[model samples]
Target: MLQIFSVTFPFFALVLCGYLAARRRMLPLEAIPGLNGFVLFFALPCMLYRFGASTPIAQLLDYSVFLVWMFCGLVMVGFTIAVTLNDRIRWNDASFGALVAAFPNTGFMGVPLLVALLGPLAAAPIIVGMLVDMVITTSLCIALSRLDGADKHGMAVALKNALRGMLTNPMPWAILLGGLASYVQLELPGPVHKTVGLLADAASPVALFTIGAVLARSQILTVESKHAPIPLRDYVPVAVFKLLLHPLLVLLVGVGAVQLGVPLSRFALTVMVLAAALPSASNVSLLAERFGADNGRIARIILVSTAVAFLSFSGAVGLMT
Candidate 1:
């Protein structure tokens, strides 16, 4: 455990530093988006591309890992909505809540951190899980959120918008282009590849720091606003589901699939389980707010899950390793 914490603590501490910086106005809230843009558009995509280019196309699209993670994610989405939905919380809030429960912060946090913990081989499963979350799970949850509206075409419209959003996202495209480059044995010019590597190298620390800044900005906004106190039922259960139950569910289902003769790698299963254990994606709050859902509930769940993940994630790493 001490050895694991030695690895994990610095990552969490970077997060704490960003949180404190934003909280103390050392990093102004307005500047958070610039950080987010740099990481998302410039840094993270390059990192994914670098890893993806090196990884074989087969590993990147490992159907066994992809299917297993996708199935488990759907179950979480449904289970969370079932448990949290009520008269007050309708489809908009409930579905976004389910989203946060099921959608781990894999793109920004998991790709770099899991690879750091489990080595380069871990990138394939982590990317597979990220693809599943971004392509399938996210679209489904967004579509479900539209069920609250009277618009007859709400689901279809939401699904279209979600797919469009995914298309605009550079990460998947980077992975895809990298996979193609890998598949065809293509090489970039020396300078171009070097530039990509430079950006890729900046990804882990910068992305992790950006996560903390975003979370801190959210926390600050949440505290300053005069909204009704969010009930524990609104957030805690979802956070618990994200940090504890989601990973357990992934592990159990992954093990079952292996027992059932699925050609799943134990290493991939371990990666998927850890991916499931990550905190809720911070972007979900923005999604909720945009779609007229309860961003407050989404924010609370994200905050709680991220705060708890330090202990739970390290513990899982300790136990799994």
Candidate 2:
């Protein structure tokens, strides 16, 4: 209990501090992009590079864990799509809604928090989960979203765009470079290593704070907007799936995988479960807005699930510990 809090408290406390600062306008909203830029472009990549550089390539290439995580994500996406379709939601909106339900905040929140709780080695599973989300889950959602409209893009094009998006994302590149260094046994010069180490050290705290600040900004926007109040029914299902069902499905799938002789480590299993329990990815709302889906509903889902994740995530970590 206290032990678990000791481990998990600082992570959420940083988030709380950031949220309060932003909510009170203590931190200027304009500064957020710079802060995010530092994390995404520099600090986080360095941290992940360090992890990948040091870890064995075989451990990083564990397909069993990837498969299990992807299976659970696909299941959630399918279930959400079916439920939304039953409600007569447009296919595009339904696909995005399903995505909101399935995709966890693995990059910003999960990576730092998991590494904090489970150590740098935990990055392996986190990265695997991110790949699953980026490649399989997101591609499928995008394909389904394209199905309803006059976009006329074939599944091949949709998948290609998704792959291109994944390649453009710096995280994967950092991971790949790190893995290459590790595989080749190339040593970074002392000065460069030290610089990367410095940036890597900054990744966790800054990233966590950025998440809190973003959440606060979202809350502020929701309050000031003139849009009609979204029905609880509209976002609640997505919230439930994001916070509860997704993790549950992952856990079940992981257990079954272990029974079938998958070599998932205890730490990796714990990391996967915790990652699944994270809030919905903030970008899902952005994607919804871009694709002309129900962005408002998706935004509300992100806000509510994130607001509730503190307790849910704490409970998850505590239980696993």
Candidate with maximal lDDT: 1
Instruction: List where candidate 2 sits over 4 angstroms from the true fold.
Output: 86-88, 150-161, 222-225
lDDT of 1 by residue, 72-93 (tens): 8999999999988899999989
Query: Which candidate has the top score in TM-score?
Result: 1
Q: Which pairs of residues collide in candidate 1?
A: none
lDDT (Cα) of model 1: 0.88
- Candidate 2 residue 242 Cα shift, in angstroms, is 1.8
Off by over 4 Å in 1: 150-153
Instruction: Give the local distance difference test score of model 2.
Output: 0.82
Worst 10 residues of 2 by lDDT: 149-158
* RMSD values, in order shown: 1.4, 2.4
Query: Measured by TM-score, how close is model 1 to the native structure?
Result: 0.97
